[model samples]
Target: MSDEQQVGIVLVSHSGPVAESVVELARGLAAGGVTAPVAPAGGLPNGGLGTSAELIGRAAASVDRGAGVAVLVDLGSAVLTVKSMLADGDELPENTRLVDAPFVEGAVAAVVTASAGGDLAAVEAAASEAYGYRKT
Candidate 1:
């Protein structure tokens, strides 16, 4: 993939399984091998229901391919934790962004867009747009 399409993705949730499931679903939606790196940073180190800045920071770094990273969080705390993580550390890509979108739908949209060679902004927009999706 081109540099513009190499933007990575991070999924953060209070539950580990929830974050992982989103990754799985997004991967399944991808046409071929995932175009960008995707990782799940969820739960505390002890596996409890909580957010961890350390984990999120690491996940962001792990997926970063120099194109940037888009993080989708499930809860308010998740957002705070992710922000704190990114702020506290210098590991995340310089263009990393914490997206405001639904956990599952946003992840699905972001992953698909990223895999299709969309830039960071495009991928982020795709995730955010999920907020207006209708199920009629």
Candidate 2:
């Protein structure tokens, strides 16, 4: 990926202090030889209700500046929160895409795929594949 084409992965959850959980999962993926930047959502002191989306956007922007970004969020309110934030027409970059991947499995798969040097398409595909591995 180009210096301006940084790829970002987010693990969003309703649970407060999601960053810790995200780090744990990221660590697991890393142990398997996957390396990618993983950002968590929720429980920041000043973060608003839509903090997850905001954090995702910030992380993406940090890497790509104005390039397109991809974000993956967990279940429950996180989905709606992210959707609402993105739908508000805030100045998100043209390539920015906020994808709602399956909670646990998708996040893990996305992190793994990203860590393996997978591109945006590969990361998205891995997230979809994660659903297939869901335990019923």
Candidate 3:
């Protein structure tokens, strides 16, 4: 599926490297092939180890494709930053959703679903399922 029809993905983390690594891993793990836009929003602009609202906002805007955006956050403050943006109702693009799931797992699931041309709801569901994932 073309990127235009696939939901965009944003990975937010307190560490910049962690966010970027998750994006790379998710794209690599997508079975259907990743055609959707995925970007990493992490850390402060000065390379500190904390979430930044400005960076998160920019990343969401960067990957927006009119198909909606699935944002997966890696830490507590990261979630808060995203929530603030959502509450504002204007910091991000239209149809942007802050997915509540494990950072790495959710990001991979979201990308896989989006790669298969899944809509926002489907992608969110797939990612949410990761919340119950277990290894035994």
Candidate 4:
């Protein structure tokens, strides 16, 4: 269950399992350490490989807590789909943002920040900063 007081997160990807795995991985990375609401908007309603505006919208709404929603997407079409939704301005929540960050790294960062009671901007920054992560 979501905390309903922190920023929400949405993960968008071309593959259903991949997106779902990221959500599980992110939450596990938090390790019972976070209350951030994370939803996966992957593939299509029919389980095909593609992005769906409906899924994205529903995912965004699923996690909306009035704090805001930070969306992390994988690859091209996912980005395009999110961008289109944001442009429409009605398909998603009022404060939903398409975070410009790495998929897995950013999801971890975003979830942690949001669970820590960070606000919308703070969560977005944390996720965006994940792009600079170094494993070397």
Best TM-score among the predictions, by candidate number? 4
Error of 1 at 77 (Å): 1.1
Residue range 1-136, candidate 2, lDDT tens digits: 4333335665666554665577586658557665566666554346444345555556555544332455766566666766776788674545656665676667777767666666777778877876666455
How well does each candidate superpose onto the true structure, as a TM-score? 0.89, 0.71, 0.93, 0.94
* Pairs with steric clashes in candidate 2: 35-115, 68-95
Misplaced by over 4 Å in model 2 are: 1-6, 44-53, 63-68, 91-93, 134-136
Against the correct fold, how does model 1 do in TM-score? 0.89
The C-alpha lDDT values of all candidates are 0.86, 0.61, 0.89, 0.91
| Whole-structure CA lDDT of model 1 | 0.86
* C-alpha lDDT (0 to 100) for residue 55 of candidate 3: 87
**How many clashing residue pairs, candidate 3?**
0
Whole-structure CA lDDT of model 2: 0.61
Model 3, range 25-130, lDDT digits (tens) per residue?
9988885567888999988999999998888889989988888999999878998888988998588999999998898999999998888889999999999999
Minimum summed lDDT over a 10-residue window in model 3 is located at 1-10
Error of 4 at 75 (Å): 1.1
Best-fitting candidate, measured by lDDT? 4
